[model samples]
Target chain A: MLLRLAWRNIWRNKRRSLIVIGSVIVGVIATILMDALQNGMIHQMLFNQINLNVSNVQVHKKGFKDKKDINNFISKPAKVETIIKNQPHVKFYSKRVITFGLLSSTDNSSGVYIYGINPSQEKSVSIISKSIVKGKYLDASDGREIVLSKALAKKLNVTIGDKVVGMANTPSGSIGSDVFRVVGIFKTASSEFDKTTVFIPIVSAQQMLNIPGKIHEFAIITDKYENADIVSKALQKKLGKKYEALSYNEILPLLVLQMDLYKQLLIIVNLIIALALIFGIINAMLMAVYERIREIGVLMAVGMKNSKIFSMILIEALIIGVLGTIFGIIFGYGINALLLSGGIDLRWFAESLSSFGVGAIIYPKISLENFIQIITIIPLVSVVGAMYPALKAIRLEPVSAIRYV
Target chain B: MEIIKCENLQKIYQDNGVPVHALKGINLTINKGEFTVIAGPSGSGKTTLLNLLGALDKPTEGTVYFNGEVLYKKKRRELSRLRLENFGFVFQAYNLIPVLTALENIEFSMMLLGIPEKERREKAITLMEELGIAELANKRPNEMSGGQQQRVAVVRAIVNDPDVVFADEPTANLDSKTGDNLLNLMQEMNEKKQITFIFSSHDKQVMERAKRLLILKDGLLEKDN
Candidate 1:
């Protein structure tokens, strides 16, 4: 009987209930899309950073990263390569000989970090081979051929087939100089990274620096990002004292910290939305309570306890919560599905987004966890909102309450 | 037999900090099978005396006893339960719950007592048949005529077969004919069931019909005959 009474009480003022439910639906949709959009952008930024440079994890000689000189080459590059290839969940890895050098053309000169890579193995870990915007990429068999970033090429006033000179310190404490033709100019999302780096065949770099059969770093891409830490730990133990392994998170701590801060800010945003909903619902419920003051007195006079009255009002609030939540979840799912399928395109502002290292197209992700979390949160808001009104209903004195207008 | 006793009962109203006594030391006793009325003009404390006797309000200077148990000393929850199990009420304005139908109003108190749905419905239907309102069972308060709503209110008051029924200006909203019919119905029920009935009214016809009448003047009991 209380359930029937509660259910009927909710619809007595149809327009007010509808307005509250509408606001709840709008809030749910807004939170869903906003969360997804933020996730999409941040996920893309992390992904780009990982693929462009970090991969999932990296293995480096003890001192190679701290000092980019050729003297800090890996102790046994072949042995480490064979061990990694045999490890479980290891998708692909590319060995690279790295050095910092000054590259000069007839017109200009700029400081550049040069990577000497095997053309075949590098493709599995990154899309560098596919980012070629001008001329052809270097072949493993070809020496004295280099790929320069478009921004770096422009800065040096060089193009495909233009001759450039590179100078770096060799392991023997002698200056190594080589003349090379810029075989390709690539454009990645990051203009800064593009302008500061160049790539050449591994053999050419080893020969130029007078260091044979040596490489500085091994970039490993795992089957999934979740496996990165596990593989890094395993590789660190397997590779022993010769090398150190680090996951993408360790390699990019600042980005990880920024993502964590963003998640906390989203929580604050959700709380603010809940507070707004509480304010909106409390007024409507209070009005319902006041309008039925005499009715409450009648109930009490007939032996209905204050606790029973409290339960009745709470049940009414619960009905509103159920109604609003049903609509809100459905609408949120519909919007999430649409966005997930046809990603929101920000191609018009691609240049600006690229500077932040995020992709132009974004597909918002709504996990089951987030959906459940949001649904759970909304009902609590309803209960909290209805408490004050329910208490007022219970506090009525039957004799005088009957006289209340 | 259940008995209600009121000794030197007084009720004071504080309006804008000025104390006005509504009941001034009334001594009264009511028995189980009596049909009683408290009659007076406006500001004569008829309603106030009824409210105090029914355990709906407290007295300022005296005590009310229900079957040797002090009414004023019981907690609010206890008093509410006492009313739920032992008393029923019919008000002047046909105050049926607007959301409920005639049958639901009849079943309201029984429902509060945790009566089973099948049994409560059966009891409600039997009472509706007795009152010639069986056909109006599903009709809401607004859809019914004033006489019909008042009849429904009377049915609701006695539905629980309570030991006492308090009717305050029960026929104020009804026409003379409907009021007479309702009074006859109450008289018949009081005789047949031997359940006590108490009323607070200024109507002359109602005062004449009462088996016992308590009249008040200027917040003091003037006569009990």
Candidate 2:
């Protein structure tokens, strides 16, 4: 009977009830779309950084990360490479002889982070080969090939096949300079990375830096980033000593921090929207209570309990929330489907996005967990919204209420 | 035997920080199955006494004895249950739930008493059939006439077999013929069902049909006979 009364009461003013229901639908859909877009943005950013700039995992000497001293290069490169090759989870691995150096082209010299990579293995591990704009990637056995980013090539007034002099401190504490011809030019989303970094053949870098057979890092790509942590931990345990294996997130904490920050902001935004919705519901219900004052008085005079009145109003809130959530899920998924297929183009902000190494286009994604979580929150918002109105309703004085003119 | 008795009943209404005395030092007793009327002019405390007797309000300084139990001392929830179990009320307006059908309204109080749906529906239909308004069972209030609505209200008041039925200006909105018909129906219910009928009204037809009349003037009882 209470349910019936509540159900009928909401329909007493269809427009008013529909307004609340509509607001809930709009709020939930907005929440879902925002969550999906932010998640997609974070997902794309992580994907680009891991696949192009940081590999899923990297193996370094124990003290190498903190100091980055040339002397901290891997101790047993050959043995670790063999163990890594046997691991099925490892999709590709490349040894890098990394060093901070300066590159000069006849007139200009700029400080650059240099990576000496095995061309063939690196082709499979990084996006550099595919990102090439001019000339060809390095030969497998080449000893003197180099690739310069478009930004760096421009900064040094050099282009493809131009001669550039690389200078760095040797392992023996002496300065060494070598001239190499750029064989290719590549561009990445981040102009800063392009302007500040270069790559050379592993043999050429080993000889120039005076670090023979000792690579500073072994960057590895896994079948999936999801499996990277387990593989990294397993390899860390297997290697046992002298080497520390780190997943991409652990190696690049800044990217992970940004992702977490986006998630937190999304939650706060959702909470604010929900709070407003709850208040909206409360206001609507209070109006319903006020309009039906005489009816409520009649009900009370006939023998309805205060708890029954409170529960009926609360049930009305639940009904509104449930109805709104259903519509919200439908529209949220509908918009997500359309957006997922074509993606939301932020190409207008391409330049700004490129500066941070993030893609301008985002494909909104909705996870089942997040969808269920939002669905569950709607009713709770409704209940919270209904609280004040329900209390007001049960507190009516039947004696005067029945005589209300 | 006394079914209801009130001693030194006093009611004060605080209107805008000024005390408006709606009832002052009135005492009364009502026996079972009596067709009683509390007759008064406007602002003469007729409705105030009805509200107190129906367990709808607590007197400022008085106790009401209902079936030898203290009505004013019971908690609000206890009062609600007592009202549901023993009393029914009909206000001046046809206070039918706008959303409900005639039969649904009739079965409302009984349904709240935990009566099963089938039993309540059967009883509602039987009562409507007896009142000759069975055809109006599925029609909401908007579809019913004033007289038909009042008839449904009367049926609802006694459908639960309440010990007492309280009506406050129940026929005020009806025409003279409908008012007489409604009074005739209430008199029948009192005689046949052995239910006490108490009314707060200034209607001549109601006063004429009353077996006992308690008249009030200026918030004070002038006569009870």
Overall local distance difference test of candidate 2: 0.88
Off by over 4 Å in 1: A62-72, A136-138, A209-211, A339-341, A347-352, A367-369
Clashing residue pairs in all predictions, respectively, total 0, 0
Clashes (candidate 1)? 0
lDDT of 1 by residue, B141-161 (tens): 999999899899889988888
lDDT of 2 by residue, A50-102 (tens): 76758999999887776777888886799999989988689999999888999
The Cα RMSD in angstroms, rounded to one decimal, for candidate 2 relative to the true structure is 2.5
lDDT of 1 at A56: 93
Q: What is the Cα-based lDDT of residue A120 in candidate 1? A: 88
For candidate 2 chain A, the 10 contiguous residues with the lowest summed lDDT are A365-374
Q: What is the TM-score of chain B in candidate 2?
A: 0.98
lDDT of each residue in B1-225, candidate 2, tens digit only? 799999888999999999988889888899999999999999999999999898888788778999999997889999999889899888888799899999999999898899999999999999899888999999999999999999999998898899999999988999999999999899999999999999999999899999999999877889998
* All models, RMSD in angstroms: 2.8, 2.5
What lDDT score is found at residue A235 in candidate 1? 94
State which docking tier applies to candidate 1.
Answer: medium
lDDT of 2 at B186: 95
